[model samples]
Target: MKFSRRASANWKGTGADGSGSISTQTGALDKAPYSTKARFEDGKGTNPEELVGAAHAGCFTMKLSFVIAEMGFTPGNIDTKAKVTFEDGKITNIHLDLSATVDGMSEEDFQKAAKDAKENCPISVLLNTDITMDAKLV
Candidate 1:
């Protein structure tokens, strides 16, 4: 199975003094905040890379929760953070940290389920970024 999203951005001015507008094919045009000098500096919002990080974190958390449920435990909460680090002008890695609280599960079981989720989740497969996952049951 395959899915794709298309987005385009138009930039005006120079770095540290320029701005841009990024819009997706879905009809969402986001302006980068002009007050700050950034890579996507143009309007008053976030960049696509930031949005991708958000989606990765949310998706991984939900996938982890589902894996835990399959082991007969309900997840109380999942706190996930994903960082996309760029190195040498290219995305080098996507690091993920997930803390999960579940009812009626041992740390060992949670670890196993987390490993499964990291490997089996759709986003992990779709993204070309290297993944580093830190899953702890608390």
Candidate 2:
């Protein structure tokens, strides 16, 4: 199976002085603003790193739920946070912090499932940077 998603960005002026708006096909981020200040310094609006973090966190959490179900455990309240580190004009690393509640699952089993999901999630596979994770079964 295959799927495609689309997003668009519009920018004006030079890289340092320019500003842009990003829109997604799903309308979730219709003309959302982005700028150099937002990306490299404290400013309003969103940036690529923030969006990547959100996507990674959401993808990993969902994948973990599925992995738990596949392992014959019921998953609950899975929460994940992804930190994308950008350095020297490149994405250096991504760190995923996960906490989840599952019924009748051991710490070792949950760790294994989280590791599998972190390694196999679409975003994890798509990123061409180091990915690390810390998982806790709560």
Q: Candidate 2 — number of clashing residue pairs? A: 0
Top-lDDT candidate index: 2
Per-residue CA lDDT of model 1 for 39-133, tens digit only, reads 44445566556767877888888888888888898899999999988668666788898888887899899889988888878788788878998
Tell me model 1's lDDT, rounded to 2 decimals. 0.77
Q: Total clashing residue pairs per candidate?
A: 8, 0
TM-score of each: 0.74, 0.97
Q: Against the true structure, what is every candidate's RMSD? A: 3.7, 0.8
Q: Which stretches of candidate 1 lie over 4 Å from their true place?
A: 1-10, 13-18, 23-36, 40-44
> Candidates' lDDT values, in order?
0.77, 0.94
The prediction achieving the highest TM-score against the true structure is: 2
Question: What is the alpha-carbon lDDT of model 2 when measured against the actual structure?
Answer: 0.94
